[model samples]
Structure formats: structure tokens, C-alpha cells
Target: MSYFRSVALGAAMSLAGVAGAAAQEVQERTMTLGHVVAEQFPYHTSAMFMKEKMAEETDGKWTLEVHPSGAMGGERDALDALLLGTMDFTWVHTAAMASFVPSFELFNMPFVFHSPEHIEEALSTLDFSKFYEEADAAGFKLIGIGSPAFRYPMNNIRPIETAADFEDIKMRTMGVSAHIDTYEALGSQVASTSFAELYGALQTGTVDGNENALSALNAMRFNEVQEYLTLLPTVANIAVLVMSKSTYDAMSAEEQALVDEIGKQTVEKNNSDYASMDAEALEAMKQEGLKVNEIDDLSSFVEATAPVREKYSQDLEPWVRDLMAEIQELPSAK
Candidate 1:
């Protein structure tokens, strides 16, 4: 009996030693998160929230160093940096990501998502295993999906309430094929310009207008350069918080769990923050001399852009097509 008791005590001590070593393996480290948005924007504010939460969850062992305002570069550049291991994480909208993952073009399909709430519902309930597999193939891990709002046409030249309003209007797009095709379908002359140079382009009349989520437009102060904001929900602006797969793989399982948890929380924080910001920004912009209008006849614009959707859907995989159909069928605020 004494020999059995002695053996059990030694086994327990060995297990404790192993557990201590495992805990010691989790070293204090800070990861970098980058995005091309103003500091006051939800992208930055939510990142800061993640930063604080990460440190608390890890007991100060893990933290984040966030860079905003294009300090790291545009969305594409940031994605490249992640692939090259220079950036650990980045927040990028689906439109910018479509070039890297062709299937992502589904998210950029014109008029697919009716409203921001519809997007949120679709993302939360969708089976995205295939999307994640593609992202892994591209050497990145999608940590979270955030739909702050829908993109709308904002211009300096005139109010756009119908497809006719887009005629001969020069519009700047992210150079995504779908976006370019959509604007062309609507009869707008599409101009390709880097997002960093968009403000200057709008100010100099190089481009008459552009479309973006209200949060981004407000944060960039597009109202200062543009005259009208038409509340036509053109597309759901789906922002993904992504991390380098290599970086995520390097972390201990426990640390990865912490990062994943915080990434998800950041999404909720962003959604809440954006709702407040959008309402306040709209009211403030109106008082500051920005003309805002709502589309009375959305069917005309939808009909004009239908070709853009059909053109892109021709090459989609079966699963992607099925998912797209389901998302479109989701209930919308509109």
C-alpha cells in the first residue's frame, strides 16, 4: 500500500511540473494590427478595445500595437505585409479582399446584401468553412467578421437618387473588378485611384464621387470635400479582421484561444460603436452643410446593376452560389 501511495504522489508531482513549464512557455508579446482608417473610426477604436482586452485576458502577457490612418499602408499593402510576415494582423473590407480570394467577390456583388443588419445575420449564421479554407490557402486566418454599415454613393457634384443621376458622373472605386463593373453598369465613368489619394481626387474634381460605408466617409471627413450623400445601400461593406496564419500558428493553443475570443468581441464593439457614430455623424454632417438624401426609387438602380451581379456569378463555385443565394434571402431592415 505504501509503494502504491508513493507512486501516485510522484505521478502528481510530475504532472504539476509539466503544467508549470507549459504556463511558462506563454511569453509576454505584443502583436501588430494595422488598418487604413482614421483613429476616431470604428476600425481603430475597436482595435484599441481589442488591445485592452487582450492584455487583460492574458494577464499582461499578450498585447496588441495598433497602427491606424494608413500608417502601415492601404488594405492591399497591409495584406501583402501580413503574407510577408511584416504585419501580424490587418482589418480589410471584402471589396479589397476580392482580388486575393476570387470567391470573396460574392460579398462585393451589387445589391446582394440589403442592409447592414442583414449582413450581420448572414455572417453569423453562414457556414464559412470553405471561405476559411481559401483564406488558409492564401496564408491568412480570418479572425472575425464585422459589418458596420452599407456602402452608399457620396459625391461632390450632385445628389444621386436614381440611376440617371450617375450618368456621366466620374466615380472613384477601389479598383475591384466588381465595383468597377457595377459603376459602369450604372452609367458612371469609373476612375481607379488609391484610397489614400481619394480625398485629393475628390477635391480636385479628378473624381466626382465615390461609395463607402458611412463610418469611413465620416471619419475621413469626405463631407468636407463632397457635397451630397445619397442613402442608397449599394453593397454591404464586410470588414474582416485577419491574422497571419504563421503568426497564429506560433502562439500556444491557450494564447490562440485568447486572441480568437478578443477578435470576436471586437466585432461586437465595432457594431455598437458604428451605430452610435453613424447616427451622430449624419446629424452633425447635415448641420455642417452636407446635403443628404434618400433614394425614392431603389428599383431603378437595382435593375441597372443587375448585370454586374450576373456577370460575376457566372464563375462561382456551387457552394459559393448556394451561400450567396441564402444570404440574399436573409431578412433585411429595408
Candidate 2:
């Protein structure tokens, strides 16, 4: 009887140990994701997707609460909060990220990425290790790269078919140096406007024009304030989904893996959805009475902006410079 009792007790202890270890593999917590875009935009849509999938995948062990439309402040403020471990996640425009991680300036250069298909290819094939390293050093862990569409000029002024059309046109741009310099180089006076304040500025005529993806233009109701959208494809509006390094560090290995998996899925969904959204939004805007024009001869605009590209790329790290060349060389399709 004593021998039987000893074996039973040993087995009970081992079973308890296994159960405790398994329990520790996933920690329960509610995380927050914040961005400065309308709920109808890709940024918010992706966040909500992430939130739902994370909850299902983790079996309620983790919850993601999303805040949209500057509830957590602008892009810079959200990034700062992430570094201080106050915010868990955010998806910011690559131009805005240049200030936080200088290497991101490589993405802000004009015509570096030819189209959405080209960007998708470059992101999958190019070496982003250097970018990831720089972001890590800046307290951000980049989990995914996504883009809606190339940016085009939108303004109440006449359609910008030629380089000369930009002359004397006041334009609003994010306060990034690369964007500001590029617009100024093209002969347009630039206003460094907060994105949240941009619609009001346009409505009040504080600026004559701005540039953004068609989906964004529609989502923000730019059609109500601006009359035309010129399809110039000046630069790719890349969006990066990042998590707080400290928050990542505090997660269990299993939990971290779960986050990574969900992050990739979220961006893949956003990118696929953007293709359709861009088309649908364009038609929606047209029906709303917004004039749209396409420029087949981007040669004039490209030539004018060539100097701006050269100026920005001149000082990039060798790896980034090499990556830029590789990306530009990739086929526009496939």
C-alpha cells in the first residue's frame, strides 16, 4: 500500500507542474493600437481586424483595443507613446517615420516604387533587415509593410497636367523634410499641415492642394473640398505596423509568436483590400462630382523631380541606397 501511495503522489505532482508551465505560456492582457486616421480608412480597418483575430487566436488571453482619428494624438505622439511603453501598437506613414528612423527616408524619395504591385514585390524580396535594425534601435519593432496606392495631387486649382501647373499653387504636406523639399523643388509653396486639420484648411482655402492616395482622399471627404485629383503617382504612401519594443519584451515567447503571426495577416488583408478600395473609392468620388485626370506623360513631372530624388538619396546609408536601386529595378508586375 505504501509503494502504491508513493507512485500516485509522484504522478500527481508531475501533472500539476505541466499544467502550471502551460498556463505561463500565455499571459492575459489587453493591448491598445492607436492611429490618426478615420475609421473607414485602412489604418483603422486593419487595427480592428488585428483586434478580432488576436482575440480569437489567443482564446481571450489577449485583447486589442483600437483608437482611431487622433484619439491618441498625431503620428509623432503615438510613436513617442510607443517608445515610452505607453502605447502598444500603431501604423504610421513611412514619411512620418523618417524622423524617428532616418533610414525610412529611403521610402520617401519620389518614384522609388513604381506601383502597388512593385511595392509588394520589393517588400517581399528586398532586404529589410537594416530597416528593422534601425527601427529596433528607435524602440519600434516593425511587424509588417503595407501600402494603399501611390499618392497623386488633389486640389481645387486646375488639373495639374504639366510641371508648370504647380507654379504658385499652395500645397499641404506632412511636415517631413523630404515631402516639403520635394514639393518646393517642383515650385509649389508648401504648408506643413497637421493631417487632422487638413480638411478645414482646404475648405477655408488655407492651402490650394494636397497629395494622397485616392482611398484616403475619399475617406477624408476631400471631394467635398477639393475639385480635382491628378493621377501623377508621385510617391508610394507606405504604412508600417509597429509594436512597442518594451511591450514585446514583456510577452511570453508563445505570445510573441502569436503577435507576429497576426501582424503579418493583418497587413496581407489590408493590402489585398486596398486594391479594391482604391477602385471603389475613385468611382464613389466621381459620382460625388470630383473631377479626375490622368497624366500619361509623367516624363515632365519625373524630370522635374529627378533632382529632388537625387538630393534625398545622396546621403542614404550604403545598404539603403543599394536596396533602393534593387527595388527600382524590380518588375512593375509579378
Candidate 3:
């Protein structure tokens, strides 16, 4: 009777241990993260790496379902969907975000970022807490920045080395007013062209030129259609990752910490990858026989477009002006 009693007691202790372990297990969640680039693009590749890390670090409690190539929708559409609780997260160009958050335009300001390193430093030291707070009020949260999207002018007309070359060139630009204002100030004929329609427009002479990050030019195979590329990366393609604020708020503290860590890790990795990818894209475009020219004196271009800065400053809200001042005070990219 004593031996049987000992056996039963041991069995009960083992079962209790198992039950406690199971009870302490982290909850499983499926995160849906989306980007506009195809799988081959570094944007998608970095996202995949981050997702893998998130799942592994959390012991498979968090698995990500990535949507690439705009399968979810355009960047703006994804932003809207996030508010409706249909999309959980997105990484999109800052230009696409400017419509929803006007202050975002500062990132895409012409000649703002001198290099990847410059922008990377700005990312760390810049005070975007206000923007984050504003995002929360509007149902979204700005988590972190992504990509080294360096924008340059690609055209069917001629190689552009100086602002003078822009005279009357029909340039395709995003619907962002700053771009239109900048190009118009430089004497280029600006027209809004959706990314999907740009290739056809350039091929058929509807627009003589367009400016985009070198990665985009290579990814979209624009070199095959365009004859010349201005090596001036006028606008850095600033991108950011965002999530639904309400959803984020609802997560457990531990889960929220994991999300924040993952976002930072992903941003750092993407910036490193973007440097190499941008170089490769430029080389590929050159091999494809696109004439590439460098602006010997960018001051000429800057001087010609000064009014654009004034125009924006005179009209923007007071807080935006203060934000721009902070950026201007940062050290230029080395």
C-alpha cells in the first residue's frame, strides 16, 4: 500500500509540471506584412529575413505572412486598409505616405539626404516621436524607416548634367506637389504618371523622362526603354513601415517589445542591403547602354531650384518648418 501511494504521487507531480509548461506557452500569431516590390527586390528580401528572425526569436509564436508585388494593394491603399483593420502592416515609399501625413514630405525633399550614410544617421538622431504620435491619432503608427532608395533622372530625350538640360523636358513625376514644384522651378514640364504607366509613357514618348531610385530603374528594366540617366540622386526614396495603432496597442507588453525590436533590426538590415543593391542597379543600367552623366556642380541645380524651398516654407505649417530646420542642422552625408 505504501509503494502504490508513492507511485501515484509521482505520476501526479509529472502531470502538473506538464500542465504548467503548456499554460506558460506564448500565444501564436500570424502577422501579415506587405510591400510593393516583387520577391526579387531587396525590399522583399529584407522583409523575409525579418519575418524569419521574428518567428525564430519568439519560438514560433509569431509567424509572418508576407505579401509582395503589391498583392495587397498600392501603398496608399494599404495605408487605408490598415485603418479599416483589413491590413496589418506595410512598408511604402514616403511619397505615397505624404498624402496621409503631410509632414512625411520632408524625407523626400530634394537634395535632403547626401548619401545612405547621411540618411542612416538622420534616422537614428532625428526626432520622429511627434510624427509617431500623430500617426497614432490617425489609426496608424510609424515604426521605422526602410531602404536606400536614391532617386535619379532617367530620360528618353538626352543625358542631363545640368539644370539647363531640364528646359521643357516632359518629366513624369509622382503626384506629390513638391516634386512638381521642384521640376517646374527647374524648367522641366512636369506631368503626373503612375508607376505602372511610366514604361509605356516613356516608350511612346508621352513623357520624355522620369526620376526614380536606381533600384527602381533596374527592377522595372527602365534602362531598356530610357536612353540617359542623370547620376544625380536628387531625391532619396524614403520609405517607412507602419502598423495599425489600435492593433499594436492591444498586444501584450512582451509582444509589443518584440515588434519594436523586429522593426529596428529590419530597418538596419535593409539600409545595409540597399547600399550594395543600389550600386549593382546602376552598373546594370550602364551595361544596358544607358548613357549616365554626373552633375559637376550641383550648386547650379540647387540655385535654380531655390524658389521651391521658399515656396514650401512659406506655405507649410509652423511645425513642419521646425522639422525641416532640424534636418538642415544635421551633418551632411560623408
- What's the TM-score of every candidate structure? 0.84, 0.85, 0.85
RMSD of 3: 13.6
Residues 18-115 of candidate 1: C-alpha lDDT, one tens digit per residue = 12223455678878999998888888888898888767666678779999988999999999988888889888988777768778888888888766
Candidate 3, position 95, lDDT: 81
Between candidates 1 and 3, the one scoring higher on TM-score is 3
The collision pairs in model 1 are: none
Decreasing TM-score order of the candidates: 2, 3, 1
In terms of lDDT, the poorest run of 10 residues in model 2 is: 12-21
lDDT for position 116 in model 2? 63
Q: Return whichever of 2 and 3 wins on lDDT.
A: 2
- Ranking of candidates on lDDT, top first: 2, 1, 3
- lDDT tens readout by residue for model 3, 1-334: 2222232234221111111112134468787888888787666877887788767776677788899989998898989988887777788888887778776777766766655556756777877687777677777878887775567888887778788889999998766777788788878999777888989988889989998777778888888888998877577787888987766877776667667777777776676556656676777777778888876567767778777777766765677778677766688542
User: Candidate 1 at residue 245, lDDT?
Assistant: 88
Off by over 4 Å in 2: 1-24, 192-206
Instruction: Please count the clashing residue pairs in each candidate, in the order shown.
Output: 0, 0, 0
Residues 176-290 of candidate 2 have per-residue lDDT tens digits of: 6777777887889998778879999999999899988778788889889999888776777888899999999898777777778788778876765566567777778889999
Model 1 weakest 10-residue run by lDDT: 12-21
lDDT (Cα, 0-100) at 129 in candidate 2: 84
Query: Of the pair 1 and 2, which is ahead by lDDT?
Result: 2
